[model samples]
Target: MLFNIFISDLDIGIKCTLMKFADDTKLSEAVDTTEGRATLQEDLDSLEEWANKNLLKFNKTSSSSVERDLEVLVDNKLHVSEQCTAVARKANRMLGCIKDTTSRAKVITPLYSVLVRPHLESCV
Candidate 1:
């Protein structure tokens, strides 16, 4: 997640790691620390940066499953997908007779201001 932290915090940490790896053309020291993983994923997830960097990938055949946040996984895979969709579909059908706007944006804005907008701005 993007955070509005001082750029020095990110830039120095990032520049140090890049220089460390670049100094040794053979990559004698591998980055396997927690901080290293965070820096690597940040670079990989960045559109402009990742395209300019070398990619690292795993073979599908060599992949193994780890617990994933069901709502965030790509295309909704995992056993939870099946259960969530089934429940949601049934709930939607159950709501077929409803005609209401009581749960609309007008009623939700005050609550959302405290919950969502500030987080969005900070992240961006």
Candidate 2:
């Protein structure tokens, strides 16, 4: 018999869904506590077992790349990727706006709408 693995958050009483696109699989959950972390770890272990049983293996390099990103987020407290920062700096400079200088309302509004709005909106 074949079955898909499902993860549940016992504390919040919600089930975590796994998303897959082609060969890419994503597992996400709101992990803010010890129990949540343990639950996620358990789910990962189960996934590894299931993959091995089905003759499927995760890409090691991709897994490590994701781990590095997670480490950066945890250590920095901000999900500021290289591309995002570059775009933000470019946006600020495009309209002759300094980082800390107070600019006129008209200039600031358009600068934000054109350059910064897309990056902020993309996160959501």
Candidate 3:
């Protein structure tokens, strides 16, 4: 598409990796050192410049310390405990609902697989 062609060279001369999917563009780099942080900032500046040159705009507010993708929450530090906890809580609630609805042991296994297992599996 024309949009893809226009931004295809957006990663040129950049040290970090650029992941472009649909309307989302993500820039990723390890920021373990001061130099690494500077490199990330430089990449951000380059992206802003590219947007300005192409007459495109970025939604600044969407840039956050934590981002959710594929039902997984990832923070800037790459911590996923919050995601695990959230998924666990959701699955627990589903289990509780199943418990309240049926006393049949055989039915619970099928219900759990259909209703609760996906959350546990996906978050891991």
TM-score of each: 0.19, 0.49, 0.74
Error of 1 at 122 (Å): 1.1
Candidate 2 structure quality by residue, lDDT tens digits, 1-124: 1222322221232245566544356777768998788877777777777667667777755322222332232223445465455556655575455335556787677767876677555533
1 versus 2: better TM-score goes to: 2
In candidate 1, stretches whose alpha carbon ends up further than 4 angstroms from where it belongs are 1-102
1 or 3, greater by TM-score? 3
lDDT values, one for every candidate = 0.39, 0.55, 0.90
Order of candidates by TM-score, top first? 3, 2, 1
Report the Cα lDDT for residue 90, model 3. 96
**lDDT, model 2:** 0.55
* Clashes found in each candidate (C-alpha, N, C closer than 3 A): 0, 0, 0
- After TM-score superposition, the amount by which residue 61's alpha carbon in candidate 3 deviates from its true location, in angstroms, is 3.1
Ten consecutive residues with minimal summed lDDT in candidate 1?
A: 20-29
lDDT of 3 at 95: 98
